[model samples]
Target: MDAPACAATAAQAASLQALLNTYLREMAPGSAVLADDRSTVEIPLSHIPARLRVRITYFSATGPHRFGPAQILFDGSSTWHSAPPVQVLTLIAQECFTRLNSRDAGQLPEFLRGLFNSNAGIEQNLIRHAGTPEPDGFLAAEQALTFGHWLHPTPKSRDGLTTWQQAAYAPEYAGEFRLTFFAADQSLVTLGSAHQAPADMLRQIPGLDGAFRLRPDEVMIPAHPLQAQMLRLDPQVQALLATGRLRDLGEAGCAFNATSSLRTLYAPGCRWMLKFSVPVRLTNSLRVTKHNELETGVLMARLLKHLDADGPRFRILNDPAYLTLTLPGRSESGFEVIFRENPFAGTDGTGIYNLAALTADPLPGRTALLTRLIQQLAADHGETPADTARLWFEAYLTCMLDPVLDLYDRHGIALEAHQQNSLLDLSTGLPSRGYYRDNQGYFIAQDALPRLNALEPSLTQQPALVYPRAHINERMAYYLVVNQIFAVIRRLGCDGLAPEPDLLLQLRRRLTTAASRLSGAGADFARYLLTAPALSAKANLLTRARNVDELETEAQEGLFLQMPNPIAAAQPQPVQERTDVLT
Candidate 1:
């Protein structure tokens, strides 16, 4: 194979190995082969009894290693070599099914295909990004995620997109396309907004030229290109079109580039980011907007507006408006689109990056944005890389964790602050602020409803959105603690800036201090996080293997496994005097 092909194969194999290793550790703990020093361990495959060597990392039990370029082997011996990633995954799946006496082994082939497609998507994205001149800092960071979620088995998979469509709409490829617009009669449109009417919001968006002017009785709504095609075939949409209630305006306005979230698009000079409901399944769930989610967005915006009275440390990128068709019996028409506040509108010098993309490994041999930022900080301050890493992490925790916990403790609002939904704004290589987006993932605790209702009376109408305190803690523990913070610690370690244990120790110190300053439930939660024996992490591999739609599963109901808490495991050290790292 050629060099590029060989690299792609290696990436696929590495992803598969990561998934399998997670499964073995969680599902069959006794299968691991540990070294005397515990720095390196091996997992003996049940199907072949041959060990696959892995290097140890923080939080998780294992990290990636190079057995060979594209093939996995038993130790350094060439005698026992496994096939490609797909075949290896199939073998592991077969063994897992046989062990559990489950019949869902059939799902393995589909997941394997997804893995291949994901690899292809990454390859295409790399080629496109290499050929294209770099974009602005924020957009470049947004589109830089080639290989997606480090833990997901098929992070780059676009299940229903064709190769051409993938090139035109996938964010990694820097895809840009005109959004398809439709004119719906005023009577058929359901509008919701926290600030302005949905129709007014649509009218204010630039680049919708006079050629696509709306009539007095019609309201404009935008749809993704693929979603537009799907809408044309939908019975409800066709019925409305047949009755002259909905008019197809075709594709119009300026080209919008897809962001990291495939359905969300960004247009230069536009005041709002458009998030459309696409029917295609990406990763674990179909990208469709439900009515409740729209309602939740408006509610969240109102709550944030109330919270903003007391100067929030982080900004909530609110989805202020949504446009959707209101069919007689159908709650959602699959053409729902949200108008989210655009923070990048006027800031040309500042850098805003999706936290997930920032932490991801960049192209081979290239330093990731996080690593580059740390190196630059070290150079600027004349500090060691390790010290810079510790300082940078301190600032990050202060900016990110404090606000997240404050919201949960004070208002009962638990954000889905996973890496993808969270963003960090950096000023001169230091974290200046943090932002959290996504309306579908916010959770409100039942205990805080009265306070929230006092702030916004309409919030009490949807009691189902409220969850128990324990449930919120679990979700927050996974997303904020396990997936977000620990992932950053691991990345810093992997990049050689600092050892993972040192970072964990620093994090524990910070959390301990924060906990002392906090009160009530927040203080207890912070203390728990600092010394929890184990943490609940989403089991992405097992979740995908079960062919479950994560969105459908409740936050607490999805597959979870206990990962040893690095903070808890670290030995206590003398507390150092805190410095003004934020400066």
Candidate 2:
């Protein structure tokens, strides 16, 4: 095959492999029959009417497995043949449709379309970026996630973006664009800040290209360029523009690059990173900020300041301010912008990376980024790759896992430190510190309400910020243990850095030791991880199939599923469950 055709074929295979991995782990966990030699796995599509089965090349205990073209068997047919991704996805969706309730079953067609769109996006990324030189620094890692979420079925599905727009806006495309500005009358705008005044931070955002200045009587709101286009079609915004209450200043800013999260923009030397509400569906939900979320972020920032000083070497990049329009009869004006403190500004962001970006799969025929980092560290220290990786994993636990557990134990606060929301400091060739950046993910346990009320009387009053203790425990299991830590194990195994079984043992020992030292829910959580036969995990495949908007879903929504715990499986002896279990 020629080079371009070969590249397209490879990209499709990669997309199919990712889809299959998610299907096996989340949808049909126990149904896959593995060969004794461990060379292939056969999965039966039991929910579908057709008597079909899929045979793949390889399988992994952790989810990142090698998969070749899948051989499929049709009903009452003795012959087997290779099937394309579209066919496989259709079969999977049909199976899901059969299994879901009538209401959810209606979402099948949209789900299938999203899968196709995601695959097309992946193909475009691979073919277009084939000859492009890799960029450097913090932005480099942010732009490095060519293949998006490992477990998400429609990881790169851009529902509202056109082909040209994605090229200009997507981080994978290494795109940079000017921010759209709007000057709204201060009376019609709502501004909140936990630290400096909101206007002061706006003034420091360099590069206003046109006649755009922050006025005392108005609020300057910066938005994603795509959002500006969508807002022009809104009747409320048009009425405000006609009445001279809001002036569209157009695009007036320095070129800001898209971060891993496409809605958040970053510019070098900028004091604050601007996160705006874009009118697009990135994965599961529309990328619009809620009014309650803004209040939650500012409250969390203030609460963080009052916490004890002797915490671990972990910091949460604070979202201390926000700017938005408060229109009558509207919950969101599509102009919500958050001012997040940018510590990785200028020359200081060299070795810091979003953990998701660090762990993302490389392009076809390229070495994974994490593998290269581990190899370089091993070579520098004159140590074996296995030894270096083991040390690296231990350091990660200290920096990332320890801090999260400590915070939950002491404050009953759980940050959604999932792979994408997490940051790792690799400046010293080892993880020395960890950071989390998310405004809408902080969860305060109801048990800690009294203590938090003493600190800030209205902290719990913030909308959707507090949850029952059991619910928080469930979220901790899914976000921290399953999504974040298990991903590390899978990467190590997939990249051939270290054995997953060895890493699982290492993780169990660390958690066991932690369970002995930690207090309250933290200790119980550790114990739960060690002893629970099944742990909660976000069922991304199923969530997509059911068309659930995760951000808009209530606490009782069915967004999670139980998966067999690898940690519990690694234990040599069966441990007794505690009466006061946190999960």
lDDT tens digits, residue span 453-551, model 2: 798776857747778877777788888888888888888887778878888988998888889889877787888888888888778878777777876
Candidate 1: worst-modelled 10 consecutive residues by lDDT: 61-70
Candidate whose lDDT is highest: 2
Provide the global lDDT of candidate 2 against the true structure. 0.79
Deviation in angstroms for 582 in model 2? Answer: 36
Off by over 4 Å in 1: 1-3, 47-87, 130-136, 309-312, 554-557, 575-583
For candidate 2, give the lDDT of residue 421: 89
Q: Compared to the true structure, candidate 1 yields what TM-score?
A: 0.92
State the local distance difference test value for candidate 1: 0.74
lDDT string, candidate 1, 128-159, tens digits: 55444433367777788877776776777777
User: How large is the C-alpha RMSD of every model relative to the true structure?
Assistant: 3.0, 4.6
